[model samples]
Target: MLAVLASVFVISMSGALMPGPMFATVLAKSYKSPWAGAQVSLGHAVVEVPLILLIYFGAATILENDITHLILGIVGGGMIIWMGLGMLRARKAYAGGTKDTPYNAFTAGIILSAGNPFFIIWWATVGALLVLKIADYGLGGLTALVLTHWAVDLIWLSIVSGLVYKTHRLWAPALHEAVFVACGLLLMGFGGWFVVSGVLAIG
Candidate 1:
């Protein structure tokens, strides 16, 4: 059980550290509110919790189906591409220092996460495997795995948000815009990869 928890923490943190849609969203929102990352993580948990439960209840088979993966890949990839374009357009607004429309950070988190095919795929594979291992120790192990995974997300995202908030003034506008553009590009790249992978899988 101890090993399971430790492994979960390490793996979860590794995923969290990667630059994904959620990470990009956190960086964009962090400039406005230090709590943005936590809010986003909470929203992410909203989707994750249910999915985890589903996996625990033996819904892994559905996730593993090639057809299901193809559908998720197409839909999720399209959504991610749309988000990336939105972020690019928002770069001007960000540079102009215009206040963004009132929105719920938590909800944004959930949407970004739900739209990410990689996130779903990870849970279907790596996450499912972890769950199976933890299942050996019964419910207690499962509980530990889930909690540890979420805790890592919360801590890491909070730190990132706080850091961005604190350092907002230090970065030049051009530098900030550049960073945003880079994040947007990374997202688009991932989105394209997902689409291609899905197509290949279907073929």
Candidate 2:
């Protein structure tokens, strides 16, 4: 049980640590309102709650479906690339110090999160492994799983928000632009890899 929890914690932390649209929005919001940034993080977490449950509960059948994995891998890869390019393009606008609208920030976080294929892949694969492994422990195991994931998200998001709040000057428009550009490239490279791999498998 301890081992299971540790594994889930590590996976959760890794995913949260990745700089995606959600992370970027949190940082941007931190510049304006830390509470709001937290709220945004909460909103993303709320979505994950259901997503995680669904993936865990369906792991057995879901993993058996080759076509499902193929589609997920392909879509996930494409989404990452799209987001990466978008982030790169937004660098200029971000560096210019544009004000963030509450609606825009919230919407951006939710949309990016919803469209994120990496989240789907992670939950479907690593998430499935943990949930299934601990399923024998019943509700207690399930609770631990959820809690660990939530804890990882809470800690990481708070850190991200805090960084922006505490170091807004250091995280000027230029810094934001640079961060996005770097994240974007990472996403693109990884996403492209997934897409290509999926295609080869299908072929």
Give TM-scores for every candidate, taking all chains together and pairing residue i with residue i: 0.91, 0.69
Q: How far in Å is the alpha carbon of 130 misplaced in model 2?
A: 2.2
Kindly state the number of residue pairs that clash in model 1: 0
Clashing pairs in 2: none
Q: What is the C-alpha lDDT of each candidate?
A: 0.81, 0.66
TM-score winner among the candidates?
A: 1
Give the CA lDDT, 0 to 100, for residue 8 in model 2: 87
Q: lDDT per residue, candidate 1, 73-139, as tens digits?
A: 7887787777677777787686455855244579878776776666777899999999998888887
What TM-score would you give candidate 1 relative to the actual structure? 0.91
Candidate 1 weakest ten by summed lDDT: 95-104
In model 2, which runs have C-alpha deviations exceeding 4 angstroms?
1-3, 14-47, 55-58, 99-122, 171-173
Give the per-residue lDDT of model 2 (tens digit) for 1-203.
99988888887788788766567556655666656455666677766777767766674455435565577567766775776676567656654556333255455455455545556656666677888888889878888888888878777877777777777667556676675566567667766866776666556
Q: What is the lDDT, from 0 to 100, of the residue 30 in candidate 2? A: 67
Q: In candidate 2, what residue range of length 10 has the lowest lDDT sum?
A: 99-108
